[model samples]
Target: MKKLLFAALAVFAFSFSNAQDEGGSATSQGTWLIEANTGNAMVGSTAFTFTSQDGESVYNLGLDGGYFISDDLAVRVGLGFGGDSAADTNIFSYRLGAKYYLGGEFPIGVDLTGASIKDAQENPLWLGLQGGYAWFITDHIAIEPGLRYNLSLNEDFTDEGVFQFNIGFTLFL
Candidate 1:
């Protein structure tokens, strides 16, 4: 009877230890996040640039990073660049934002975004809001799909608002 009890207790303790090591919440304080996006919104930022396929060539690239300030909260910044070949237009983009994770998975954020266009008189600015779910594929990797809305602060340069769906890849360190 004593041997059986000892074996059971050992197995239970081992299992508990392994479970604890299986990577706690990625949104926990002190974690770092690096992200990229494939969609309209720039990775890690609220900024969006114009892209069109109306017989002209357009390309954009963006990257962003964040550091958790407290449990489930992070401040992020990102930069993006884009150009239209046919129109001979170039855009430089920037974003600054804060994100909060709900229940450690659902993320919501608000940000400020702006773009400077070559030869353009007015720079476009926007206030952005976004929300999404973080689907963790590994201990440190996540795929996030979200919706974002950017309200144009300078409507003279662009539309009143832009709505987009974005998919983001993230690494939590």
Candidate 2:
């Protein structure tokens, strides 16, 4: 657990440094976010048992930094901590991804992520892909709705994959 926390902190620190070096503003370049999601198993026979009622609710707190590579494109890196009730699970994740502005105040994008979780007595690593659309309500606030599919890579856990529906609010800076 300590190791995982250390690694997550290290990644966030590195991203912060990079954003600073690039002269990124707190509101335009860096963001703090809060997200909530419900996850269900979508594959195999387990699908039948994975209803919204049986699903787990997860909450996450994270930081994201946008590095503009072009007017409509930006590279984004985010790190977060998450918790869920099904198993009283704790997760730490870091994502390196990109976003594209769709000629509006809001932008739509896709992200691929790698995550680690400690649930009950097991620790597992996961790789996931997600896509979302964000509506920038203001210069510092935005709302995003997304979907995620995650595959577990290591053992000490069950559940082969997770299908998640997410809604998040972000405050830039």
Candidate 3:
């Protein structure tokens, strides 16, 4: 998990200086955006615990899609897989939501996501909000680093509050 965190940070650092200093407007309406997202929880312990104690890192790989309803607004959906070594758990997660692009030469924005997590014993739901700066490295590619806060709707199989740092790439298609 620590390695995962470091790797993500390294990627962000490597790309940071290369990103154009100029700002850009959001995707235009009718444009399609596809993204590959990777992230894990910001845990207090290292990865080898093999138990849920001291918290565990839960990693996720996902595919996300967005369609601009207008230049400043878009609807999005995602599908993902998640796992944790400490809890010995594997789950399928999905989300549906929207993001309103804050227009600028360099775009920064917030997103509201509603998601579901399902496993063998229980299924839980959460709502998450993320804030980040979108760095357009190219005409069709962007790197987004964001902080997310999730509030669980039920405690049956999850924590009440979850937080994570995420980095993802969006490709305008």
TM-score: which candidate is best? 1
TM-score to true structure, per model: 0.79, 0.47, 0.65
Ranking 1 against 2 by TM-score, winner: 1
TM-score (C-alpha) between model 1 and the true structure: 0.79
Q: What is the lDDT of residue 152 in candidate 1?
A: 85
C-alpha lDDT values of all predictions: 0.74, 0.52, 0.59
**Which of candidates 2 and 3 is the stronger one according to TM-score?**
3
lDDT of 3 by residue, 51-147 (tens): 2446766565557778878886778887766567676776566677787667622333334333333445556666667777778776656787777
* Ordering by TM-score: 1, 3, 2
Instruction: Judge candidate 2 at residue 172 and give its lDDT.
Output: 42
Best by lDDT: 1
Give the local distance difference test score of model 3: 0.59
Ranking by lDDT, best first?
1, 3, 2
Query: For model 1, how big is the CA root-mean-square deviation?
Result: 12.8
